[model samples]
Target: MLLPRIIPVLLHTKEGLIKTENFSNPKYIGDPLNAVRIFNEKKVDELIFLDIEASKLKREPHYELIKKIASECNMPLTYGGGINSVSQIENIIKLGVEKISINSSAISTPELITQAADRFGRQSIVVTIDIKLSGLFRKSYKIFDHKTKTTSNIELLTHLKKIQELGAGEIVINSFDKDGTMLGYDYNLIDYIKPSIKVPLTALGGASKLSDMTNLFKKYGLIGAAAGSIFVFKGKYRAVLIQYPSNKEKKLLYSLPYFIS
Candidate 1:
């Protein structure tokens, strides 16, 4: 079995790294570039930088900051926010981003995914789904920009599968319900979506500690784990440190049986 990956999820709000509860209250932490520098030195598996307000604010990603962060970090970076067109996607690549995670744009013009993956290769694309519970069995998937709300889970899943067939290398699933709460990831969503998509899926949201992470990796047989608030914060879980698991903790996570069921 492949060793599970530990990824740091950074939320960008007007150029600063911040944490939120249920994707609301924003508390400034530090400069994003500074966080990138520190993560680089620590040699984390990968870094995911998401412009939280870009989609809601209806603005393109901050290229200036993207370049600044890219120049300071050596880890593979995945970036998303305010991407709406093929040109915008190309512009982000020009800024030195390794992968682009798109949401609002995908909801607007899904053909764009095929266009991008076809031109840049599947490995360069990552489609992120920020979903929330809708009903007893249904769920809501959002694309951001405030108005980009899509609740057709079937359509959303179809889009993801189509993008993968169009050559998307991977998919990142972020749960809006669990985001920033540090409760734990929405495992049922991950499990439900996993079987339908062919590409590897990375689960994000509601991660608070090493145990939450271990349970996620072990319980779901997930190889990619991403968290934002859990890494940030210290103290009785102060929620500002933004650090990765120590080597020993990782060894413990990796030693779990491949199939927990």
Candidate 2:
């Protein structure tokens, strides 16, 4: 069986690397380059760097910063935020980014997904959907737009189908409600959308322990498991630290039951 990709997601801002809860209350952590260096030592499967303010502030990606991080990173890198054009995608690829993740742009101008896939190959494009649970019962999932900070009327399954049909090679679903809670993933959310997804899929938000990843794999099989708080914080106090699963733990995780070879 193919082992799942364990990724550390770093949120970047003008200050530096930061962590957020429920997509609010950003706390400064440390430098992006420093985080990359540590992840390199950990020999992580892949890394995702998201410029949290780029789209909200209406500015371009920090190419210089991204270039520096990419150059220092040993594992494959995926970058997102304020990516709206083919030229920007080309330049980011030139700077060594393995994949470009688009959220806001994919909503405003979905044609860009096809355009980018055509120019850079579908494997180079990743579409991220930020979802928030709503309704009086809190069971409904809606697409949350980071730029506007509002939920759209679009249906979650409809949007997923649209992007996949538009040539998105991979899809990442992030739970705004679960972001940084580390309570474990919203399994109901995954079960809701899993059947509709055909391409590679990744889940981010609310992963607190290695066992959470194992449970996800045991239930769903191979899929990317990305987390922020679990990788950056330690213990009940949430002390700042940078770490990933060691090779020994990873071997054990893959050997756990329910995975089909």
Candidate 3:
């Protein structure tokens, strides 16, 4: 009986940790190291650190910073952005990181997924698919490219299956519109893509509250619930406060009748 994972996503720039709305207007949150130290105290299940500017700037991951974070992180850590080759993945893993997440590079070279998976094992590889709703009258979901900042003609389901077949161990579906919105998870998008994905699946963007996570678990059974804003902000004003559910809260969440055994 697999249990759902509650993960916090930390988006960072070279300057510091930041948060974005609709993938724009990156607001500085705090120091990345400080955030990690706090999450460590809270006993977070897993943590994801994405270099929001690495791929767009055409730079390699800040290995020194990653090494620091990896050394301090007490839980499994996944790092993304500007990861282009197996060497980079190996380097990140050697730094004590648990998983490597690829986005734009994977879009350009799908074979990298298989090669990295073969070299490091699929469990260490995660493929992130950023998606946005397009069109006028009837909006439809399309694959979004963070590097080009454009939607591709590729069908979403086709690409998902392709990534899984290419040996990706996990797939993270991120909503471009719901990013930083904190409204809720994109239930429709999950409904559409869940059936086609054979690998472990995680959903990011639009997770506002604990109920959002509970609703997601009730509906989907077993999946990774990853969020940025919900864990980093507090109160109606959205104050920059790093927090995670306490053990009591988590036990109650897991004890819900809808949660799978």
Predictions: Cα RMSD each = 2.9, 2.3, 2.2
lDDT of 3 by residue, 179-220 (tens): 999888888888888889888889999987777787667777
lDDT of 2 at 190: 89
Q: How close is candidate 3 to the true structure, as a TM-score?
A: 0.96
184-258: candidate 2 lDDT, tens digit per residue: 887789889998999888999998777778767778753799999999999999899999999999988777764
Question: Is candidate 1 or 3 superior in TM-score?
Answer: 3
Give stretches of model 1 more than 4 Å off. 1-3, 136-154, 215-219, 237-239, 257-261
Looking at candidate 1, what is the lDDT of residue 4?
A: 74
Rank ordering of all candidates by lDDT, starting from the highest:
2, 3, 1
**Residue pairs clashing, model 3:** none
Q: What does candidate 2 score on TM?
A: 0.96
lDDT at residue 223 of model 3 (Cα atoms): 72
- Mark the regions of model 2 whose C-alpha exceeds 4 Å error after superposition: 258-261
> CA lDDT, every prediction?
0.77, 0.91, 0.90
Per-residue lDDT, model 1, residue 139, is 44
| lDDT against true structure, model 2 | 0.91
